[model samples]
Target: MRDRIFRRGILPIAVVAALSAVAGCSASGDTDSPKGSAAPSGSRAGRVDPRSAAALRAVEQATVRAGSARIESSTAMGGMLSLKTDGALGWSGDQVGTLRITYTGGQLAATMRALSGASMEARLLPDAYYAKVGDTFARRLNGRHWIRYGYGDLATLPGGSGAYLTDQLRTTAPLQPVRLLRACGDVRRVGEETVRGRRTTHYSGTVTPAALTGEDAAGLRKQLEQAGVATETVDIWVDDRGLLVKKAEQGELVGGRMSATAYYRDYGVQVSAARPPAADTADFKELMSTRGS
Candidate 1:
């Protein structure tokens, strides 16, 4: 029962991490030119609507500078898994954060409960992610309660964005929505909206393969294509202080539709996460190796 449970639960959780990383990666924008084709007439220097461009730039700068935020998000990966997470993340220098992830529904959730538990605490650090499992899982793993997945190991996963996933998780997850808005080729104002009782300006755009640029841009594009996502729609709402208040991404992946919505607040909030005790933690790589053996 222990081996069966571990085999079924561990990889799906890892997929959750990869999916979260990929969702953030979708937000990388072209910082050099924020005036794609969505600019309005009389806009500054022939750029897209000067207001739109400026707003995006302002939000981007402010978010990066603030360094930390409280985040709540829900993600659905086709019919495979559904999850909700709430936590605080800091990216002032190195990525550090913690999230309480609950398996709300799906086959993955059932397996998770059978193996570990319905909820887990995901601890994020510069080099790795750690998930705290239930007592049953701990007993199976020589009494270790946490599973560590190092970014270095994720880079070797089979996929076009495998390497990019590692880089994005470590460097870009904090301000991904702003990055996506910056990279949009057709950004448009969607009027005013209220988010969590706070007024905010909404913006929407499509991120196509051509809009991406960078060393890993080509690879990411190919990965998206393979996942059946030729173009992704990204929307963001910015608050009065030029901070991202909410963001959403929708696209097709793994032969099914995938979508995620995230809310951000408490900008500049102080946050920290410490690695689990070595004696109580198990490395994911070692687990895989043992399973293979």
Candidate 2:
């Protein structure tokens, strides 16, 4: 029972983490703005509003400058899974962070609990992620408690090439919405709204292929094409101080629809996530090899 649970649960957590990481990365594009002044509203259907563009640029610069933030998110991958993550992520240099992830509701939740308890601590490093599983899981693996999943290893997983799971893990940050805004078209203001009790200005746009240009945009477009996503809708709510308060993205994937909503706060907060002790760690590749044998 424990072995079965371990096999089923650990794979799903990795899948969920990869998917979530890709979702965050897919929304971002090149941060460079086209040289020009802000255009008047309603100037052209395809033209981005000057104020909206400026707001996006400001938020992007501010977020990158802030370095780190507290992130809370809910993600649903069609009917495959639904999960919640509460954590702080730092993007000052390398993508270092930690997330307490829980399978709130899904077919995989029970299996996850059986293997890793009700929650898992994911420690993110520059080249890999480490998952701290429960004792039941540890006992099955020579008392190794942490599973190290290198990004390169993840790239070889099923459907990984198009998913950009590895690339996203290495490059994407919590402030991806601002990057999305840089390449967005049909940008429009949806008026002021309250997000998490804070007043914010809402903006929405479509991520069309034509709207995205440049080398970075071209790279993202290829990934989207490979993933069977023609277009995606992105919305963001920015606080008065030019910080991203909330963001939501919706798009269709090969299997079904995918959507995620995330809230950000406490910008500039310090976040330190240390790798697990080597003595109690197991490399995911070695575990997979053992299972295959």
Candidate 3:
């Protein structure tokens, strides 16, 4: 039933109504860059080279500098469609949700939870977050509360159970935005492709740090590694305007291995007035500021 609806491709519709939130350009951490050669003496106008690495580096660096953003993401995998699991693995293609992330000064503060057909809202916050899951108001002060109180980290893991285990491996590591981009290493240009009838650039890459610190994260990574799961391959399609319009991943999820893809379109980045951060809430000023933390 869910697959049937997704097959119709409602992502474009979701984008129109401000329900879609996943869009990002890759960037690397600011490191020491090599100085370019000095211009020839007595030449007011220097010859411009378009294909130089310096030019490409300048563009890449510009994309990164215009960072610190919030965007929506919709992902669908296999678990929910297969009926083997409730889609806890994050591989369910029908699994749809919104992610609100703010990267301020290179630090990441994020909260992402999925809303499925079951009318359930499972949220993961960077600091403290409260959820009203069908009238059940629950709140967590830190990451530990996410274990039983919220949906397992979705960004770290691969598939459903496998991704959940992957979350366990990186749970202790600060979920940095730059780190996420770095994990998605070497996004080589695969020429242009059409997504939803729109021309977009295609790039593929892999994730890094198969294992991380912390008990829950470490144990999960160990379990999956011992299980001999293969690494994940990511495919991305970006429009001529530099917006990510589509993304796909192929990986394993416990006994069932599958491939999942998400197509993005009419990409616009904005914060929903209906779902503002906790700081913007009426009672937030009286509670605590999400700014300092």
- The best candidate in terms of TM-score: 2
Candidate 1 per-residue lDDT over residues 108-224, each given as its tens digit: 678666555777788888888888878976887899998887887654344444455555456535466556546544677778888789999988766666666545566556544
Task: Please give the distance, in angstroms, between residue 32's alpha carbon in candidate 3 and its true position after superposition.
Answer: 40
Stretches > 4 Å off in candidate 3: 1-77, 80-117, 122-126, 129-131, 135-188, 206-229, 264-268, 272-293
Sort the candidates on TM-score, descending order. Answer: 2, 1, 3
* CA deviation > 4 Å runs, candidate 1: 1-23, 26-47, 156-161, 171-174, 213-228
lDDT tens digits, residues 1-293, model 2?
54443344345344444335323534321111122212232334467778888888888788789888888777766666667778888889988888888777666667677668887888888878888888987888789888888876654355445246555565546555556557755677778878769998987766655567543677666556655666666677789888888777666777677667777889889988898999999887676556644
lDDT of 3: 0.30
Clashes of 3: 17
- Candidate-wise lDDT, in order: 0.66, 0.67, 0.30
Candidates in order, TM-scores: namely 0.82, 0.84, 0.39
